[model samples]
Target: MAAKLFSPLRLRGLELKNRIVVSPMCEYSSQDGFANDWHLVHLGSRAVGGAGLIIFEATAVSPEGRITPDDLGIWKDEHIEMLKRITSFIESQGSVAGVQLAHAGRKASTSSPWKGGVKVPEDQGGWQTVAPSALPFSDAYPMPVALDEAGIQKVLDDFRAATKRCLQAGFKVIEIHAAHGYLLHEFFSPLSNQRTDQYGGSFENRIRLLLEVVAAVREIWPTDHPLFVRISATDWTEGGWSIEDSVALANVLKTKDVDLIDASTGGNVPNARIPVGPGYQVEFAARIRQETGIPTGAVGIITDAQQAETILENNQADLIIMAREFLRDPYFPLHAAQELGADVPWPVQYERAKRHK
Candidate 1:
């Protein structure tokens, strides 16, 4: 049977109602890293709208790991209570809830995109950020502090703590954010990591942090639920992280029991030209899945039903994760089902709008 966008897929012990996953997007609305009604409503709508999986935005594992003060946190037990409400609502609508556990690294302590997204000074409520090396993401951002052995151990513990919190919140899947110039990405990309320590330089060293984090998280995470790792498949800069490096890394992660590789690109460098268009980054997902024989989630500029279906029918990726388009239409999976002529349940409130007419 040809795999379709609305097809049910199983990874590990979880069965997705469909292949459409609402990608984690930063809402920048939390206070003190707590989830609120805004998150409940925002994520709840997608579950009602019929996404098989609802992955929350990049949630920091620690305060200093946040991209902004408003970013969601799972570092503390208090944060888990609020997240539980959101996950319960999602499950009520028959969707699996997932959380992306992340550390922003050198990208931390910035204003929200709407607030201009520039580096916020300490007096302005921004704190110093950390990275594998004391490098600035750009000249506009402050220099980051390099992580020592103690600091690195602290990071691993933070991730372990966050994973325990996710289990408490009833999340079935957890994605470790190693993409988008975040802490893990910084360590993986030589373009951002200029250190000569055991944590950087050679490919083995560059991947050390991510491998450790994944192993640590997997140790605590339930064996039944899926585990995903999002990676910027390429830096898109000359002499930077490349597709080949991603393929090699994907192979390594597969050995660590990672269930899926969410393939995305860029964000390690300031202004590398990315060839943006419909399904622009899907090729990276396809390549990695093909080369590594690991399941992958294709993301980036996938906005329509046929486009997503094509990615699946061609076996380019095992799943499709959409971001901005899902925001524009939360019930995107339901609508895409209609467009693809597949049977999908619509909210009873919206059942009258089904394609029968």
Candidate 2:
């Protein structure tokens, strides 16, 4: 019998060799938003390791959209050359190159994990952050300016421009970053968005911004290429965004030409308690897929080959997206093939070390 984990998945005009997707992770190692040798080696190693799809980190669409000053960006044409080169190498290794376009919103202007992860003041080079509401994520974070009509329009324009740059950078898939307490998430959850404008109040009002952002990007994005939206399925707090809301959102998203929902939960509320464990968020993906009929990617602590296979075999999710696991072992797909007793090609240079199937 063949392993389902190694099976190909089709979306629009792209066919991934396998369901193993490298989740976008922030490298926090760039200056003025340029991809250097670090990005090349980091992403290239995963492609060489046999990942079917490798998504670049939460690349900012604007300077103020960065979670840290060092986050990768796609706001300018100058950033495209190096990114194009990196994507070429990834595709050369038989892996698809993708990027998650993002805006940090109220969550912006913070230090990287190694740098204590606190708010960066303006005097120290931090810029003012913007969000749906003027609320701050926490006392330790910066207070954000409420986006007026013009600011919201700029957000849409930024994503549209970023999509064009993504095309120039040779990305096959584009995943909009709307999760993890970012700008889009701030609009989704009532816990964050508290305005009387057209973008707040009811579920439809709160979700309006994300829908418009998708529409803007879709206009510039090629119809043949796959587009994905990563959303935090639930806020895990009272009166916050719920799984039902996510299902409704997913249903609406499919109509807008979104190909998949990368369903992970929480991050909208800073104090919400989460039951963290292996495959903790897989159920959300399963529910979204079952309820909304949209392809969903299961993420969060899925480290083992069998664990990934189980998710696919059980009809829980269409893709297995891994972050920490890929960081720990870039050759996970190659190793997983061996573990599942499946035959997969290894790079010619590494073929001698590959186990016989």
Candidate 3:
């Protein structure tokens, strides 16, 4: 029997050679959103390592949407050339390239994780952050200006324009970063949105923006390409966005032609207790997949070849999105193929290292 981990999975017109995916991770290495040599090597190595799909980190749709000064940006057309270079290399390695377009909302304008990760002041190039409501992520974070109707339209416009740039950059997949307590998640969770307008105070209202964003991008995005939305299945706190909400949202997203729900949880709240462990979040992906009948991607601490294989074999998720593990070992997929006895090809340059069983 063939190993499921190495099996090809199709989404729209794109066919991934395997289920292993490099989840979008913030590198905080870009300047003015330009993809430098660091990004090329960082993403290209994963392709050489044999990941079927490599999604670039949370790329800000606008300057104000950046989480830190160094966060990647796609707000301008000039950024497309460098990104195109990276995507071309990824495709040459038989790996599909994906980009996660994001807006950090109240979490914007912070220092990099390695540099204290604190809110940067306006004098230091930081600008005012905006959210669905005028609430700060925490007392330590900046208080964001609540987006009025005009501000909301700008957000939608930013996403639409960014989607166009991603297409121009030759990205095969486009994942909307709606999870991890970002702008979209903030609107989805009542804990952050305190508005009484049409965009708040009800389930349909709160999710209005995300639905509109998907619709707008779909209009510009080719029907042959797959569109993905990452969502936090739960806030890990009472009266917050719940798994049931995620299921309901998934059902709605399916109607909008979303290809997959990248299931992740806990980031909308600062102190929501979570049971962190290997595959701790897989159950959410499994549940969302089962309930919504939409293909889901399981992320968070999914290490080891057998562990990823088990999730696929059980029909829990259609994709295994790995983050930190990929950081520790870019060649994880190549090694996994060897361990699982799957006959995956190795880069010719590194074929000498291929193990024989």
Candidate 4:
């Protein structure tokens, strides 16, 4: 039998060439929120490497939405030119390019992890971060201002405006960054969101902002283009967002026109005891898919070809999204095809290396 990993999966009007995806890994190398040669090489290489879909890192929808000093942005039009160039290259290589629109919430305005990962003081160009409530990820992170009604509308507007830019920049997919303790996830997780308003307290209320944001983006995003929402399936903490909540969220999102759920876990708190190992989070993805009937992308420690194939054969998940593994081998799909004895193409320029078994 042919490897399911190399099978085409279609969403709306776009059909992926394979099921192997390059998960978005944040590249804190931008300046003033612009994509440059580094982004082109970082992303374009994966396209060249035969990824079916390559999602750009969490790009801030607004300046204050950035997690670190050097994060990418899409709040303005000037950032489109370079992004367009990169996307053009990616698409030319027969891979779909996607963007993850994000707001960091209380986790914003920090130095890069390599730089000690502390709050970047205002004097150093970091601005105040905002969240569903007034809280910090930890003492090491910034204490955020609680967002009022007006601020919530602005977050929606930022997402709307960013989606327009993504269209101009040639992105075929938009994944709302709601996972890993970001703004949307913050609201969903009770541990971070201590609000009493409609955006907190009840499950319906906490998901209100995300539902509204999706409505806003879907209003502008082409109906044919795929819209993905990444969510932490479980906060792994008591009284926090759980896998059951994720299934409920997925059921609702399907009605709202979300294409897929990028199922990831943890990151809502600094010290949740998560059992870290190979494919530890795949069960969450499988549960969400089975219970909700919505396609899910399984991520987290999925590193090998046979392991990825087994997940698909078992119907555990629809898409296999790998992050650190992609960093280690950008051409993973191409190599996986070789290992599986399935036929796949190589770029003409590198045809000399097209090894046949």
**Per-prediction TM-score to the true structure, in the order listed:** 0.98, 0.99, 0.99, 0.99
Q: Residue 257 in model 2: shift from native, Å?
A: 0.3
Q: lDDT, candidate 4, residue 26?
A: 89
- Residue 228 shift from truth in candidate 2, angstroms: 0.4
Which is the leading candidate under lDDT?
2
Q: Candidate 3 on 1-357: residue-level lDDT in tens?
A: 889999999999999999999999999999988889999999999999999999999999999999999999999999999999999999999999999999999999999999999999999988899999988999889889999989989998999999899899999999999999999999999999999999999999999999999988898899999999999999999999999999999999999989999999989899999999999999999999998899999998998999999999999999999999999999999999888889889989988889653
- Which stretches of model 1 miss by more than 4 angstroms? 1-3
Q: Is 1 or 2 the stronger prediction by lDDT?
A: 2
Q: Tell me the whole-model lDDT of each prediction, alpha carbons only.
A: 0.93, 0.96, 0.95, 0.94
Off by over 4 Å in 2: none
lDDT of model 2 at residue 293?
92
Cα deviation at 119, candidate 3, in Å, is 0.7
How would you encode candidate 4's per-residue C-alpha lDDT over 264-307 as one tens digit per residue?
A: 99998999999999999999999999998999999989998999
Summed backbone clashes in each candidate are 0, 0, 0, 0
RMSD of 2: 0.9
Model 4 has a clash total of 0
> Each prediction's Cα RMSD?
1.2, 0.9, 0.8, 0.8
Of 1 and 4, the candidate ranking higher by lDDT: 4
